[model samples]
Target: MSIELPQRPFFLAPLDRENSGVDFLGLRQANLDMMGEMIPSINNVTSYIRPFSLLSWIYWKFHDLCTEAGIEEATSDDLRLFRERIEVLFTWGASLHETAERIPGISATPPPDQDGVKPLTFDAWGRVQSSTSLIAALWYGPASKTVTGLGFLSPVPGRGGFFRVSRAGAALAQALDNKLREDGERYNRLLGTLDPVEANESDAIALWSLWSPETVEHEEMASFSSALTSEEAIGSNDTLLSRRSTTFALARHHLQEVGAEQSIPKIRRGMCFSVRPDGSNYDVPTTLEECRRKWLTLQMRQLQRLALETLLSWCEDQILRYDVVDTSAMAERFKKSWALTEYGLGEARNLAELIFKLDTKSNSVEDFIRSVNTNDLPDPFSIMAEITEKFRQRDPGFAVPCFFGLLQCASFAGAENAPPNMVQLGSAPRLSLRVLRHRLVGLGDVTVAEAFEYILEAMVISQHFSTAVNRFDGRNQRLRLAIEETGLTALVSSAWVPTVTEDRLAMLLTLSAQSDLVSKNFDGEFFSNGGIKNESI
Candidate 1:
């Protein structure tokens, strides 16, 4: 038997999440009902990921690789190797150079003569030639996680340190800017006339007024973008970020200090990476305030929600879990039947709800191209906004539209994709299988494992024998049980195993001494006789 070394420069596993099942799904705590339309979960840049933190990470990683890039021994292989090292450091917070100084064969010093030739000679992240290219390659938000076309992130041209905000990004920024101005003016007019900003107004308008965007930077632009975030959002972010590595934070903060302590802040080699436009000679077309980005996000969400209604109508026609996807009602017109709270959004989410929408942003089906030629065109801003949004979805994994469940409905909005289930499932599972197991054990006195085993054993026995049980009502089932002391043994021999009513099955399990399966559950009550099956688990 033989073993081969895996081709990895940083031989450390990515860190396990600090909080494994944190919050159990953000929507449960939100004002919105988790059972209603899809929840708002920013897949990335959730409050915990501050621009400062990201900037800090990029800055130090560059410093670590700058020297290596300048060395003569650098090769293409060094790019991949050191890129992995730098990113691994960012993800797991491990130092490769420190480890190399400690470990065995990897830590050994190459002979003095070969030091300038071999990148693997272990002088540090030694082989990497161009730090900028490495930064660009790794900067596109986890190539493995993005589900977008050309993700919103397109690193700045020469210095790959900062990514340019795409035109679509600019539109989202502009869209939010427009909405903020509109809402702010509307609120002023109503308040000046002393007429109340009534409930009947658009939720966007009402929500805009409610947040008092006046408190944020731009007084006139009081949109979801300009408004100070809810206390809840702030608290959630602080709690999460507080748990990050203290060492990582200190080092990052140290690198960002100014004055004699100021080591370029975020500027290096005459190049700058900054969120604010600091006259550092680094420029990008647009840097929409955080508020604008959030605004564009909500606008897209509004459309996605509308598309969802169309999708529900679709799944109904296709007979694809129609009962779950479309819960019909005479009066509850806006009710989303895609899931019930009891089913907890059920299997609808796992139906790969967002991939098709994501695909549209890139390919824009033939239907969209045809529709574009029609005379009833929307304003150019809107059309461009939609177009740009689609382009932003190029990242294959965490496309914002999909992650937020705001799947692009371009073809979908005009009644969108007939998205087929991708051959392989990529969406992260929304529900925990363990949690599902626990819920399935619903009301049982026995552990989930025990009940599962008992069911398996019962199934095995039923395969071998059949028996009969006669009821007091003159019903003669092919199974026997109830008072039978053999209990579940009746499951093996009696026809009752196959022919008995659910009530009798409950009685059999209730009477059995070892198997603690109970019948008090909703299904048990619905399917079985009143008394016996009523025994709650």
Candidate 2:
């Protein structure tokens, strides 16, 4: 996302416009023709301009121009002009050569030559011998005046082979080496400066070492062989086979360690099973079905444990977030309601009461549902719908109990027992009686019964089972017991039982509320007073 403008395009003007006599199109065609003949010569002279192919071509062209100019036997002044032109061409070529040498993978050494004067000469095969030959020819023949005063050429005997070494030549070689060393040092520094997050020094070093001439030559040989061999094997099947074998071997070891003898027979049966005796490509099984089954069972068992832990954590977090008004009083009330003969119910009730008291100001069905951070709460509507569908597939009539069981789970205070019931409750009966009764009483802010009925219908349609009647039943029972303990309900009737109604749904709701009230009271007391401690311990 770095916002930066792109570079502008570069356009080259027509050469004909710069040189009136030059036909840009014709010149290009002529150069293409010359390129066909000069490739071999260019290759031969490449050594002198080591890394620069374009520079080698330019040097050859300058020599050709000198020859065409007929300045070989010209006056000193004319020769000076010719030498200056050739010198400019040579300088340009050298600059290009140096640039090519800096690029990774390009050869820095120039081509060599035997006959120095005719540096542009090619062998019978049209291959230029070396860059040295090209440079020597350019200097001695075309730009000879530049080096004549410098004593670059020495006279030889009758054969006309002159011993030649110009100060410029020596200076250029040193300069090339120095430039190369500087470039190498800069490259090393760049490699060292790379961000550790993107690339480490080791990686940079490996890349640099890989570009060495020796490494390149070795790689070239390997690549050439690979190219020649049409069927080059890049990866080995043996490695895959070894990995699969190791996995099965590990599984077998684990089975033996666990003393699972039945698994051995299963494994043996799986191994012995045959699909077909014919040599068909699909006859063999790629995977061990028996091993996979055993692994899945183990994985499911681990997942069940994780699910329980997650539920426990959710409950703990919910309780921790709420504020209790009267922990001791709530605990006492909880103890008496459940008729505790053991500590299990007492302790559980005490914990529940503490949470309830603390969260009393903010306590609501929505808060409770939100407190349960299980993955099940994310899309309750869809999840409930899916469960209902699953139940319908098994037995449509059972969907009601399935739904009620799910509601019960949402209302209840435990975790380990919720999932299986929630899953199976989809197939149960429509126990709306208890749910309806609780909704009427719990949501008594509206005096009209129609409002409660509307709420119930909406709850069913939206799958918002979190506010179903059983939750109110549980909460009311706790509230009544708390009131009893505190003597706050002396003026009101305490032993009232709601009348049963012909509306089956209403009756069911009332019945559910009554049942939950009695159970919660009894269980709360039992746990509060350590009645169930022995059983649990």
Tell me, by lDDT, which candidate is best: 2
Query: What's the lDDT for candidate 2?
Result: 0.26
Taking every candidate in turn, the Cα RMSD to the unseen true structure, in Å, is: 30.0, 36.3
Which ten-residue region of model 2 has the weakest summed lDDT?
528-537
TM-score of each: 0.20, 0.15
Question: Candidate 2: deviation at residue 399, Å?
Answer: 20
| Tens digit of per-residue lDDT, candidate 2, span 193-232 | 2111122324333333323211222222232222111121
Candidate 2 at residue 433, lDDT? 24
List residue ranges in candidate 2 displaced over 4 A. Answer: 1-287, 321-537
Q: For residues 464-503, write the lDDT of model 1, one tens digit per residue.
A: 1221211112322222112223222221110110110111
Write down the worst ten-residue block by lDDT for model 1. Answer: 494-503
TM-score of 2: 0.15
